[model samples]
Target: MWCRIRRRTALPRKLKTVPTTTAPNSFPCSTAANCGKKVLDYAFQRGLMHPEDMGPMTHWYSPTPRVFLEHFKPEFMVQSSNNYDHPEQQVWDCDDEKNVEHYMELTRAHIKHYGKGELFHMIGLAEWVFGSPEENLATKIRVMKTFIRHLRREYPDAPLLIASWDFMFRWKAPEVRKLLAELDPADTVILDYTTDSGSYSNNFVNWNLPHHFPWIFGIFQAYEPQNDLFFNFDRAEEMYIPVQDDPMCRGMVIWSENSHSNPLLEYLAKRSVDEPFSLGQFCANHCGDRAAAMEGLWEIRINFSIFFRKST
Candidate 1:
């Protein structure tokens, strides 16, 4: 039977105290313009933390250099198509005989550096394979399966997190579900988020995976170019209560494209860690009136942009 948290039940009022560290275990992942330092600065200035009081935190499994298949030896690069300008076309043949040894070697190096519980939280494999267009679904599944198996074999205790965009689930839910089931639930987590108007509940419940499958509900709170906020804070206020109450729902991740630092994001981060948190209180503490006004403007811009793009 699937587990569902009652809508009326209050979320637990418990907050884990932040550790004094050079980098908090949970910060925004580096994206286009938002580097780690800028994220830290935003947090610090907002009184979220003081850098001087911080210490070294545990390392997480981010593929070194943050490039796709870059960890593979130079010789391996020649075996695959290279399109440095376009990330989607930068995929290689997963079935290549030569790729197997490279994968094994890469996994070994990862295990050496981030084996066991060395990773502070979870290892991300989204960029490594999730959205790449190089391989077909069947090949992608095999590649992911092999990758997960190798990682689990070497670092049995580390939590592995894989991210997927809404399109993947919308078009290939069954295959994705099957692939996730193959991994050990205890060590795997699904970081599923939406780029448009989708809900975590929809993905979590509709996917119908085992209730034990760990998940982190991600919200793309902000985006680039216009630097506008996309999430409906009012909706989040109502929806997050039930989501947080769910046992399988590990927590929330607030993502932005080029800027991880935003007022709304800062507020969400505070709310996530603070006990006895109230959405109303959060709005009030920050400027509720201003937030409402900005949200309205953002809606107008976003709607216009969508309409304009579609018409064009």
Candidate 2:
């Protein structure tokens, strides 16, 4: 039997009334303007980005953040933590002064060349904690805390965006929550929730709404979740469909690596304003195998701008 796929409908032109409950409600959306700009404005007002220009189209190619910043001209920069092969090493082996200075040099270079007034969103990838099997939860917390504290001391003005997988619960699982609470909320925004199927399923089923932890509002959502490689929008829809009613989910970051390989980009491009109460494509970055073209794999992340009306 073929099952019918239910697609989301377009949002209203305006949210005349705020939602009073968890049921899906309609809101006014823009039609004559750019939806991307609208979303970016929201992100900026909420302090999601240091500057107002950042969007999904922002690219970060090696060498340095120069070309990426200059070309993409993103108002925000997300700096992820290094994934350590050996998890046991909490403290760096290199001298603190040298390592700190080294990082400062890189930051200074990026700032001096491409970013003068731009804001950075520093991220702590959850993979770093798993590096040490011998380390307990307490150790992990200590490590993250110290690292964040150091980053704050080094870059006093830059904002920090903490990247973490659900690990088990919200990544803000009790102990983790306590540790994060110690940090200033203005300086940190937790990028919780995940594109991983295992984590998504656990969190979705256990918690009535997709959001369980209050500290985490922003999310890193993968359009598709499979083999930790390919993200399928079909999969993402299946996982997210059940919880679209939750207002706590403020915004999301499309998994950059997965967005390029999927058909969702083209699909969204073809959608009309009458389509759904979802983001229409604002910015997109393509992703694929570096060496060879992979069949049926098109990775790209897009920021939906459902608020704007089309210009005739």
- All models: lDDT? 0.44, 0.37
Candidate 1 per-residue lDDT over residues 136-206, each given as its tens digit: 44445666675556556655676666655533433355656666667677776776555233444345445
Our tally of clashes for model 1 stands at 3
- Cα misplacement distance, residue 181 of candidate 1 (Å): 2.6
Number of the predicted model whose lDDT against the real structure is largest: 1
Model 1 residue 168 distance off true place after TM-score fit, in angstroms: 4.2
lDDT of 1: 0.44
> Can you give the TM-score per candidate against the true fold?
0.55, 0.43
Rate residue 257 of model 2 by lDDT: 39
**Tens-digit lDDT string for candidate 2 (135-250):** 44554555456555655665677655555453443243454545555666656555544533344334433433244332232224344443223434444555555445544444
User: Which portions of model 2 miss their true places by more than 4 Å?
Assistant: 1-91, 94-98, 116-118, 125-136, 153-158, 165-175, 200-235, 238-248, 258-262, 266-312
